[model samples]
Target: MIAALLQGCGRGETPVHVSQFDAFGIRIDMQLLGAPEQLATEVAEQTAQDFALTSYSLGLEQPGPMQRVNELLATTEPFAAPPALLPLLEQTRDLSERSGYLFNPAVGMLTDLWRPDPVTGKCSEPPDDESIARLVEAAPTLDDISLNGIELLSDNPAVKLDFGAVIRAYAADIAVANMRARGIRGAMIRIGSDLRLMGDRTGQPWRVPVLRGSGGAVLGTLDLRGDMSVVTVGRFQSPCFRNGKEYSRIIDPRTGYPAQGTQVVTVLNSGDAVTAAAAATALFAAGPQQWGQIARQMGISAALLIDDTGHIHLSPAMERHLQIIDRNAQVSVSPAWQDSGPQ
Candidate 1:
């Protein structure tokens, strides 16, 4: 089980409690503010446990219930589904349709092909073209999955379910809800740039910088108010190089290949982190040209995207929220995407 906010309590009055731990194959950072010392310590411990419990239930790290469920479901056997996962599946289905099937969760087989070795913590090389071609031809979708009451089955034998895109964000949603229920005041959660801010940061809006995937350039700063999730999908997070060519870990479900035409995509969600995470990846995969329509279909209010040419684009909604503190002529808003400008 992965632990939460660097173990134990922070000393002194209003001492900021911070935790750093690895979960879901990514390092997660969390900070707590404006909590009583006792509550801070308690929340930290509970946060760790929450991640651990979530991973076990979801079969993210170890052999847990979900793994067993997947094993049975991988074949043609009728298997009873975990009650908790069913709702997530339904949610993914709705999101997949809304994002034009770009936010997929049933492409586990393809993800596995790209996943690094468990021992090395790195992939030795990219998968062969033949392997990728086979998965692409199969083209699995959530539609192929059917549920008879609690029994779940996948008609497509080649299909496998992977929630890499949604798991952390969903967990963040649950954790945020749990904190609110506990009367927790303020918190900042980040799991590999799928960031969520709850309440305020010392009574001030959180100022966040969106970084370029290349040379760590600050594309812009987002001054976010209220509770919101900021999810950025970039090639820098996961990449494997072969023969001087770079490949991203984020594979396009449509082609069973890496998503193209964008350097980085950032998505904002005031409602839920799950949608924010999915939308960022989906919008990036939708590419710079098609992101506008997909963003509208997903009801995304604001986002900033860095294209392959280093051009920055912002949704009309972003202009109202983020003060472009670092444009430097490198970043510009698309008139077509400006909230009140000519479409």
Candidate 2:
């Protein structure tokens, strides 16, 4: 996971307030600058509580709102979508469409096929090809799910919902907004490998580590300022290994199998973290050959991809932001992605 090495103290050397807490099934590290210690602590507590509520609402394994929604989806009947979940689903569906469904969250059954052992974090046996093919043929997608106002329903029974891919970024966006609302000017939220930055860091840009892969050595650092998101997707995210081959947690919705060909892909966006996170996943699934095209479709300008062969590919925009450390590392800069709009 990437860590924001908070450089320097708070403004005028006031000392930044740092807090660490576990929520949404991951550890969240928050650093707030230009705020009183008491105020920062209160904001952190409130943000943690908000994350708890989001977890309860969106969690599928637990007996909560999302579970109930999934149960109701099985019957193919219209029901009122939970207030907390409706907007998120709407946003995710739009993102899915933008990525040509490459970033689908409706393949919960497909995801469950590759679920890892909680303690071992690995699947002892790889899912058989037949099981994967069945779900792929069923073709469950966010398109099958419909929303009208607060009412929601699914025409396809195979379409199950899982927001694990984007919720952390979504939560971080909310936290950052709440922090800004409270008059705090500078802060950063590091949720897993994804980071959301607000304002500046003691009048300087935020420096965040960019790993080669999940838990892999640091490839370089990205200097970011203002409101932006840096999201990385890699094989170490829920990987399953059987024998010697590794299976990534990022599943190709069309193939119902773990995506391959790309070791890691990180996208930086001056937009909401949710879109940035989804683009990273889609680009990873798109593999090295098609990442640039899919990234263009998703309106992502800055992205870096490390292919399976260890070659580093950078978009023109990304090349400007990242400072590569290894002078001998193979690097190629792609042309700027012109906005042709979504196809």
Candidate of highest lDDT? 2
Estimate every model's Cα lDDT from 0 to 1: 0.77, 0.84
Q: Write the per-residue lDDT of candidate 2 for residues 27-117, one digit (tens) a residue.
A: 8888888787677778888888888788888876567998888888878899999999977888998899999888998989889888887
Residue range 181-224, candidate 1, lDDT tens digits:
88887888888666888987766788887777573666567877
Q: Which residue segments of model 2 deviate by more than 4 Å?
A: 1-12, 335-343
What are the clash counts of all predictions, listed in order? Answer: 5, 0
**lDDT value, candidate 1, whole model:** 0.77
Identify the candidate with maximal TM-score.
2
RMSD of each: 3.4, 3.4
Write out the backbone clash pairs for model 1: 4-48, 5-19, 6-19, 6-20, 316-339
TM-score of each: 0.88, 0.92
